[model samples]
Target chain A: MKATILYEGKHQWTVFGRDPDKPEKIIDTNQYLVSTPSRALLIDPGGIEIFSSMLAATLHHVSVDQITDLFASHQDPDIISSLGLWDQVLPNARLHSPWLWESFIRHFGLNNIEYVPLPDDGGTIDLGDLSLQLVPAHYLHSSGNFNIYDPQAKILFSGDVGAALEADGAPMFVDDFDEHIPKMKMFHQRWMPSNRAKNDWVSRVRRLDVDILAPQHGRLYRGADVKRFLDWFEALEVGVGV
Target chain B: MARIKDERLAEGEVLVSVTVIAAELSEVMKIAKEISIGAKNAKAIAARAGDKARGFQPITNFIDDMARHTLTMVRQIDQEALSVSRICSQEIRTNDAKRRMHDVIRRVEHPSLLKSFQGVVTDIDARLIALRREFDKRLDHLAELLDSINSDMRAATAISSSCRVEASRAEEFREGLGVVADNLEQAVEVIKKHVKECSSRLQHAQRLKQAIYKK
Candidate 1:
């Protein structure tokens, strides 16, 4: 229901979430929008219910016409179900999503907007001034998953990779990493499917120079807390649902 | 009312639109059948009033013929509306199938299957558009038919007033026939009033269709 600018510069990074008004049974999602002067790319633009809220929130930061691209990390109602709604307003906008889920996500109603598929290996997305890397985080939770890494800002929009299922109105960033482990433990263990894939994603992301590890749900990990999350997640026995 | 405000109803909007139009057509069809029955009753009443009610006979017969024609047009519209509903339900079913097989479809490297999916989607869209245009044209035609029926009802009402005056000459023999002529006039007016209401609804539906699909 609100858009908070996490990073501000010529290229601004805004997080649209932390809704106290979100319905009881729905999972709260963090929709990340990276805005440039001429173009903007929205990552994981939430679902059908929060569409009006998302559009209203984004309008506070950038005009609806300014959003030139969209990225859906994977196909889940919570992640990208708003694709159908987006088709009406942003008819000219291009969708940067995993190629695997093109036909699947189309069932969510994607007739107007063009789909620019992200290869299985992942790739880079170009805004007018800045370009973000779409790194493959396959099987982190969804089979064809990705994490958007903004090298200039050192922020990794990690999709649901480090997501914690905390209550609504939770803090935007974790101050105490140890205290936050309980909120994320079950989500990572249960929702995340493969241990091999988890370790591979963690190891690969550890190599990145990340200042902020922003997940689609719960609070983000900032600076020192980013390393704390990686270290804790590395040893955590994930893929328990497997 | 607003032009595709929910945006999420993008393709699914066709289903909502068609359902609303079909329901309106059904209501109109029901009334058309009632009007037909009213005309049949009027014809029987006119036969009892022999020479005195002879003037009422031709007006009642015209009403009867118009009722039949109206019913035929209504039935035609209803069938087309039913087809739209059938198409919508079928699309919903096929879309569900596609969603379930998405992961399976990805695993299997069959280009033909993906092409077939695209083909199906395109065909459905085309069919929906054609059906909508047909509904729009029929709605216009129905409105025109209702106007003609209203005009005919007015003429019958005027003629019935004169017949009532003529029958009043033989108070003993044709007094009963005056009442029959009044009943026949009332039946025509009832049909005309209903047809006008139905015509107004059709106009509203046309406006709604424009808001949903037109740029």
Candidate 2:
């Protein structure tokens, strides 16, 4: 697994993905960890198959006990199927997920950790020293979904909003916005599910002071490319699977 | 490496044994109900025979009581078997988590971080111990229930013998009373067969539990 440090200020943001040992069939996913001095929050901890790799990569940075909280952007397996395993390791941690997915997500066997459900309009996760906002992205793909925005780091952990189905060894960040269009276009059109929801999400994200747009899959958009993604997504007619 | 494989195999064995016990006990329950019905029919036949079968009246009541007792014991076994199965699944999960946590601990090189991981391992260890204790307690209760059923069913053969002796005196109703005795004996045999199989399965599971925990 590759670990990229997106921000290394007072509160650090690291992305773990591109596992060299991942099985051929399963989709590649990116998991982000936001850590403060005394606390850490793991976002979208991936599936059950990749748990060992995820844990080993995470342990290289923070201790198991230091992971005080977990965040699930949606109920998708690729997003949070590792919750049950995480429930076993992090005895004192709390899971922050969508309120609509509380009962549904619990089916993945959650017995140890506390479930802190996020309300429809969105909420905040306080890491003692740093606070991250849970921005609403409902129907961008899932009926109940969210994107984590770290104001301190100016990075938006977009769940599946800007995801692209790329090859195994794709670059971590988008270097060319025009060339990356084809890689992301089909995924957004088929999976986003609603044009109204897409426009709403785009408008809401444009209002935030985001420097890096880190998605759950494929490459992230940074600097000028972040604006380019918003402009392109706003005009694109999604939910084209009808 | 062989020890680890055996432990993993034992983990699955415990769950399978409890499930088989529950399924077999359900068969006992069905046959026990049939015996109760057979007892009722014999009672009616004895009443019709009146003075001729006066010796057989009390035997029918005994058959009914035995069937009822077997039913009660089998139901308790079924419930206990289900509870044990659930606890076994929980223990398996806790043990697997402990193993994985240790794997993580071994991979870490930082001395300070290793200490923090140890805290998580300590908590997992305590939980695994509690689950194992709970599982053992449940298994002991299950064994007691199985023993009670076993002892109770052993009396069926003697009761069937008494029924045969009394049925011979029924005179006109002798054929009917004999058929009732035969059905009771058949039902008891089926119940006893399943009960014995369940006992053997539970004993096997208990042995595996002891072997796994002794280490």
Candidate 3:
């Protein structure tokens, strides 16, 4: 598993992904950790198959008890299927997820953790010292989806919105917007079912002062490439397979 | 002395075996109900025969009692088997969680961070231990229930043999009474077969649970 420090300030944002030791056939995923001094929040903790690797990688930064909160962008297995295992370890932790997914997400084994349901309009996750905004991105893929935006860090944890289906060991950040289009095109077209929802998300994200557009899969879009992705995605016709 | 092989069974296997026990018990319950109905029919025939089937009347009463007892025991065993399945599922989840946490703790190179995991790991370890204990206790209870069913089947076999002896004295209704005896014996045999299979599954699941927790 690779851990990259995406932002370093009073609080830190570290992305853990690109696990070389991941078992064959399972999709690779990127898990984000936002660590304050006394509390930490884990975002989109991956499936059950990668729980050990995710937990081991997380220990490099914040200890187990320090992980006070968990956030699931939606109820996708690749996103939070490890909730049962996490429920065992982080007994006191609160899980912040879409209100619509509260009952569905509990099916993933969430007995001990408190489920702090986020309304459809989205809400804020108060990490004691820092507060992160949960931006709604409904119908972009999942009916009840959200993206975590850090205004101070100028970064958007876009869940599956900016996700691309790339080959294994792909670069962490999009270096060439034109070349990356093919990797992302098929995934967006097939997975993102609503063009209206895609345009809505694009317009909403455009208003945010985002320097980094982090996704849960493949590479992230940063700086000029972030704008390039928005332009390309806004123009592309999605949900074509229907 | 020969040593027992250290066999590893997945939690799903144990759960499936326990669930199969319930299904087998359900079959036993159906057979028991048939036995009860057969006993009622035998009683009716004995009443029609009057003094000719006088001795068979007591035997019919005994068969009815056995069938009722078997039905009650099967219901109890079914409930216990389902409980065992639930406990097994919970124990497997807790065990897997504990194993993953241990892996994380082992990989933590930083001493202070490792120390921070201690409290939570201890808490999880305690939960795993409690679940294992509950699982073992419930499994033992299920074994006892299966044992009681086995004991009831033994009594049933004896009553079935007695039923045959009384059937020969029925005179003109000899063939009718004889058929009733045969049906009772056959029902007992079917129940015995299902009970044996259920007991075998329970034992296998118990051995697997012991082997898993022994480590």
- Please tell me which predicted candidate would have the highest TM-score against the true structure: 3
The most accurate candidate by DockQ is 3
**Model 3 lDDT at residue B52:** 90
Clashing pairs in 2: none
Encode model 1's per-residue lDDT on A37-149: one tens digit a residue: 88889999998767656765666666656889999999999988878767755668899999999999998877679999889998899896798998899888889989999
Instruction: List pairs with backbone clashes in candidate 1.
Output: none
Ranking by lDDT: 2, 3, 1
lDDT of 1 by residue, B138-188 (tens): 556655655665665676577567657655653454656566556656665
The model with the greater DockQ, 1 or 2, is: 2
Q: List residue ranges in candidate 3 displaced over 4 A.
A: B1-12
Lowest-sum lDDT 10-residue window in model 1 chain B: B96-105
| TM-score of B-chain for each predicted structure, in order | 0.57, 0.94, 0.91
DockQ of 3: 0.72
lDDT of 3 at A176: 85
Which regions of candidate 2 are displaced past 4 Å? B1-10, B207-215
